[model samples]
Target chain A: MKGNEAIAEAAINAGCLYYFGYPITPQTEISEYMAKRMPKVGGLCLQAESEIAAVNMLLGASASGTRAMTSSSSPGISLKSEGISYLVGSDLPAVVVNVQRGGPGLGGIQPSQADYYQATKAYGHGDMHLIVLAPSTVQEMATLTGEAFDLADIYRTPVIILADGAIGQMMEPVDFSERKPRELPEKTWATCGHRGARKHNIVNSLLMEPEELERSIRDRFERYRKIEENEVMCEKYMTDDADIVVVAFGIAARIAKTAAQIARSRGVKAGVLRPITLWPFPNKEISALADTAKAFLSVELSMGQMVTDVKLACECRRPVDFFGRTGGVIPAPADVAEKLCAMSRELSI
Target chain B: MVGSSKRIIIVAGHFGTGKTNVSVSLALASASRGSVIIDLDTVNPYFRAADSVPELRAAGVRTIIPEYSNTNVDIPTLPPEIASVFFSDETAIFDVGGDDGAAALGVYERDISRVGYEMLYVINMYRLLIADPEDAVAVMREIEGYSRLRFTGIVNNSNLGAETTRETVAASVSYAECVSKLTGLPVVFTSVIGDARAPEGVENVFVMDDHTKKLF
Candidate 1:
């Protein structure tokens, strides 16, 4: 399955009955797939006039106690950011997929991880953070999409499936049968009307009093603290007693993994630590590796956005390096392997 | 290998049906006789034949792609150089986009008809929506309608990537046969990845190297 279509199917399987999106390259297949499959499953797939409207529609659906989602590429994602902040402020549960393309603004339609800062630090405005899940393969694209919905409902916040254009366009064998049912909580806070048996449920993000808004924001941060403790997901490959640890995520990790294998074959002690959850940032794992690993390399598709987070996680215990190919250019395995070999020689490890 | 008699070959199918792989393989196989592969996939911004230009050039196959391909610009404009393939003696193979992407082919309908071309509808039984024979035929007609061209044959390029085995290829034979029967088109070939042999009853086996897998 193509990564974009896999996400749409997995979203549908996760009981997402409403899809509102606008078309953008690299990720348009998600909308096209939903348009074809949604009606057959008694779901609604609407093509909104713009990304802003689509995201607002998602907010409305989520507020009404429905599993809903919207997807876009980098530029379109920029257009949807305001509505995303609204979704978060209202404390609504929804899934937003950004099959990331290169961009500061309408940058390109090729695979890129440049949106790392946008997704994790400043998706919209104000003090906020989105639970970002990055999938390195098409299979993870499916599994993570289904998991995104559950996380949204459990945490009562918006979840972002942050994928690059490479995975969105690639084809691979995916097994959907392995997904086990998740125990999800009910939407008691939903404003789906009361039949005189209960008080009216209101959903709003606007709190007039300064203290009231501060309390609400702090309360949400408390939930975020719990998430940070329990939901940090990372995959370590051959990290035991390694001198150089390559920290990456999404498609960059896949390329880095192969490069690490090549380095290992050539007698360099290199391994990869892929953060499946980008928001939590896998700090504990990297911090622990800092004890034994002499140095770290952060590889990305952008100009070292995540490298800052990597440095912070390691606490300067080890020297950290950055390697990247920005503006829609993908580095070949040989190129990354060359970087790893050079780093090893410089450190004499 | 594609017969030398066919001067122009166009590969079209629904999305993710391995159309670009089939086109690349066919062009590489025919490269010894002076071949050119045109990347006419304007709809998809990623994983197009343009991505394989380095390997294709290494194999001595000339490639003509959209001007802004692999760049930040997402314009779908076709290059003027594409029209030259019609007058050239080199065997021209077109890797067209999937489904409505075939609409880009309509621009050269007259030139293609005048030069005479063989359009192959690539099919993968493992792909969703078009998994059934009837659904596959529907997509085939849709492509034909959009491109203003008709398919001369069917290329059974079915396989589950990475996990595909001899058994997996063998399982798709009956499905491909059903699609061939529905469309009344001959099964031109069955593409098998790497060193796999043709499934028991399948003929005209095309051994394809998985070029797209190296992209990641």
Candidate 2:
């Protein structure tokens, strides 16, 4: 399956019936796949007039306690930010997929990880954080998309599937049959009509009073704290006895994995630490590795957005380095391997 | 070995069905005969034959890509150099876009017909949407509707990427035969990765290297 199509199919398998999206390069396959499959599965796939309208439609679907999602690339994601903020303000559960392309404003159609800051730190306006899941392969694109919906419903917050154009466009073999059914909580707070049984449920984010708004924000953060403590997922490959650990996520991590293998073949103690959840940032795992590892290298498709988070995660206990290629240029594995070997030599370890 | 007698060979299929890989391999295999591969894929921005221009040129196969390919501009404008394929005697292979991408090929339907071209539809039974023979036939008809070109043969390119085995190729032979039977097109060849031989009953095996596999 192509990574974008895998996400769409996995969303359906995870009980996501409503998909609202606008077409954008690198991620357009998600909408295309949904348009073809949704009707057959007795669901709704609406291509809105714009990215903003698509996200607002997702907001409406999610408010009624329906499993819904919306996908776009970087510039389109920017247009959906306002709607995303509203979804968060209403404490809605929905999945937003950003098959990231290049940059600040309609940068390029090629793959990029420049939206790390946008996805993790400031997806929208307000005191809010999204559960960001970064998938490295086409298979994970399926599995993590299923997990993204579950995480959103569990926390009642928007979850971001932070993919890049490479994964989104690449084709691979994926098995969707192994998906286990999830135990999701009932949406008692949903604004779906009640049969004169209880009080009417209102779905609105407009809290007029400052104190009430602060309380609402604080309550959401408490849930975020629980997620942070329990949801920090990272994969440590060959890090058990390594001096230089490379930290990366999404497509960058897959490249780093190959680089680590090459560095190991050349007798360098290189390993990879892949963060699956970009928002939680995998701080504890990196800090744990800092106790033994000599240094850390953050490899990204961006100029170095995740480098800051890696540095802060390690608390400067070890030296952190950055290697990247911006503007949709993917770093080669050999180049990353060379960096790993050089870092090992510099540390004399 | 398939369509070697033809001057113009056009490869079309559903998305992710190994059309570009087949086109590249066919062009490289026929490089000694002097070939030019035209990347007429305007539908997809990534993983196009344009990405393999360096490799294709290195192997002595001339490559013609969209005017704005590999650039920030995502327009689907074909270059005027494409007309040279019709005039030259060199064997031209058009790696057309999958499904609706064939609409780009429709623009040159009259010229291609004038030159007498052979269109080969690539199929992968492992692809979810086109797993069934009926679904494969439906997509085949859709491509035909868009390009206004009749398929001369079928290329069973079914395999799980990076996980394909001899058994996998063998398992897909029945599916390919079903497609061939339904479309009244012969199964020209079966594509296998690396040096793996084609399944027992499959004829004219084409060994392909995944030139479209992105490093990152």
- Measured by lDDT, the strongest candidate is 2
Write the residue-wise lDDT of candidate 2 on A1-349 in tens digits.
Answer: 8999999999999989999989989899999899989999999999999999999999999999999999999999999999999999999999999999988787888899999999999999989999999999999999999999999999999999999999998888898876675678999999888888999888899999999999999999999999999898889999999889999999999999999999999999899999999998899899999999999999999999999999999999999999999898899999999999988888787
Range of the 10 consecutive residues with the lowest summed lDDT in candidate 2 chain A: A175-184
For model 1, state the Cα shift of residue B123 in Å: 0.4
Error of 2 at A269 (Å): 0.6
- The RMSD of every model to the true structure, in order and in angstroms, is 1.8, 1.4
Best by TM-score: 2
C-alpha RMSD over true interface residues, each candidate: 1.4, 1.3
Q: Write the per-residue lDDT of candidate 1 for residues B1-216, one digit (tens) a residue.
A: 388477899999998999999999999999999899999998987777987899999999999988888677857989899989998998999999999999999899999999999999999999997999999999999999999999999998888888888888888889999999998998889998886645776678888887784665
**CAPRI tier of model 1:** medium
> Per-prediction TM-score, please?
0.96, 0.98
TM-score of the A chain in model 2: 0.98
* Residue A29 accuracy (lDDT) in model 1: 93
DockQ for model 1? Answer: 0.74
